[model samples]
Target: MEIQLVGITVLWLFLYGYLIVASVDFGAGFFAYYGKITKQDHIINKLISRYLSPVWEVTNVFFVFFFVGIVGFFPDTAYYFGTALLVPGSISLVLLAIRGSFYAFNNYGAKDNNIYMFLYGATGLLIPASLSTALTISEGGFIEKRGDKLVFLAKELFTNPYSWSVVILAIVSVLFISASFLTYYADRAEDQKALELLRGFALFWSLPTILASFLVFVTLRQHNFIHFENIIVRYWWMFVLSLFCFIIASFLIWMRRNYGTAFIFVLFQFFFAFFGYGASHLPYLLYPYVTIYSGYTNETMGIALVIAFILGLLLLIPSIILLMRLFLFDADYVKGKK
Candidate 1:
């Protein structure tokens, strides 16, 4: 209920928004290519194209807000994370550019170039894997303050089990989330062929998502015992709820019933787990280097930022809802009747 708490919570919401929206966008790109290679593009590509057409351009808006808000609310993170993130951050940007290029070329010039599809698909996986490095580094041990110089342990990050686990989880979770949503969308469109194919894709990725989640928790115990203990002690219930949501979602998908409900459950699954992990990691933006108390901006600025971000969230959510209503869920548009 402090300003810092409100500020970070708002920022966390933006990041969570990005997690869902961007995951669907990213996963759709990968699935588009996968469908092509598997010769199912004829079945699923229309659904994927329809979903991507209206939303791809806005997928990074939440991310942009979170990145800027974090630095605005917690100036000290810039100092700690700025240099440490340069390589990985640069990689993410490059991958994003490549992905965007594919979108541009496909939309404007070359409709379905295999080379462009490969780049699109590759970036879909690589961008998330690269962006996840920041979260892995946040668990500590990957950044060292030697004198006044902050050195990023790139090799250690590459070799860390927890880092790899998080990357794997990021990719798998994207696939699962995207597939679940697309299955729902295809069903809503009543595209039976696409619906059936996407349903299978959703079921196939469901187990990997849960397994990768457990692997992250297990690896976290060894990687950062303090954070792991905090999760076990203070955050177990949220994770339990997250798992419950996952089970319900997966079951619905498997049963071939209420695909929309299934995706909603998946949303809650990540919502609980994402916010819980964030809440437990609270106070500290990055282990040992910064805490909300130590690193937060002054009261005047913090209050301004908290209010500004809260307003931003208010506006952003409604805009997305309107987008869905107008484009995503519109009776005629969704079914491609118009």
Candidate 2:
């Protein structure tokens, strides 16, 4: 394979890692707060807390790698996206900081302030919505190059249906992914009450997730017809497989059997859908502006970065597996006996 292809594939892998890990983290935050409001926190919050305690600190590792890798691999992205992303990027950073602060406050400081919890839940949805601006802008029309200065059209972005569709999809997908994994976690914990609640959550969010995905497709056709055509023409099979995985996952969850296996199918669903969307969007990191070939880093740097990230992923996955074996899935630890 070409060096650029290898480099981008590595970067995309890092990003995919962030999507799954962060979705669970973010969804847990929202559910934590929701449980508090519903007076159901007594039953579910402990389960959520146990999961977050071990995992939250490391949740951003994948994102950090992907963010750094993007600029490292595609130098031109900074030139195009840097100016356009100022507001959204700043918002994402602030929200992320707030999320981190919530962990500090919840774990080390005060136990539960409604205000703090509210922020936690709100940012869970908002952070992804803000960060999605990069993808929305890449569809073009949201930014214009005027002479040497690039102008990010805030009005256009706000009014665009496609932008909102992506944002909605982000929010719903987070909830669905998080709920599905938590359902499995709850089952592992053998907490029937929490399992029932989270299963309801998983099933409820599944519809919206699928619906939002279709909305994205419809709006993408309107917003970036060329990319939509690429998806339908060349990459349709991946999305069909993604849908099949979604059905299997929801079915198993609905049947209340093989929760672990159901969650695996959920992972597969997103793997196919996320990569399908990404693969279809490719060659252009930012449509009409930066592409893999036009803006890639030098060959030596690209090769080094790919090797470093592949090594990073290799190390990261094992570390997470060890964590699961030691804490998350451990009979004693998972049951709150440890």
TM-score of each prediction: 0.99, 0.99
- Residue-level lDDT of model 2, residues 1-338, one tens digit each, is 99988888888888888899999999999999999999999989999999999999999999999989989988988888998999999999999999999889978998888888999999999998998888899888888888988998999999999999999999999999999999999999999999999999999999999999999999999999999999999999999999999999999999999999999999999999989988899888888888999999998999999999899999999999999899899999899998
Candidate maximizing lDDT:
2
Q: State model 2's lDDT.
A: 0.93
Off by over 4 Å in 2: none
Spell out the clash pairs found in candidate 1. none
Quantify how close model 2 is to the true structure by its C-alpha RMSD in Å: 0.8
- Decoy 1 TM-score against native: 0.99
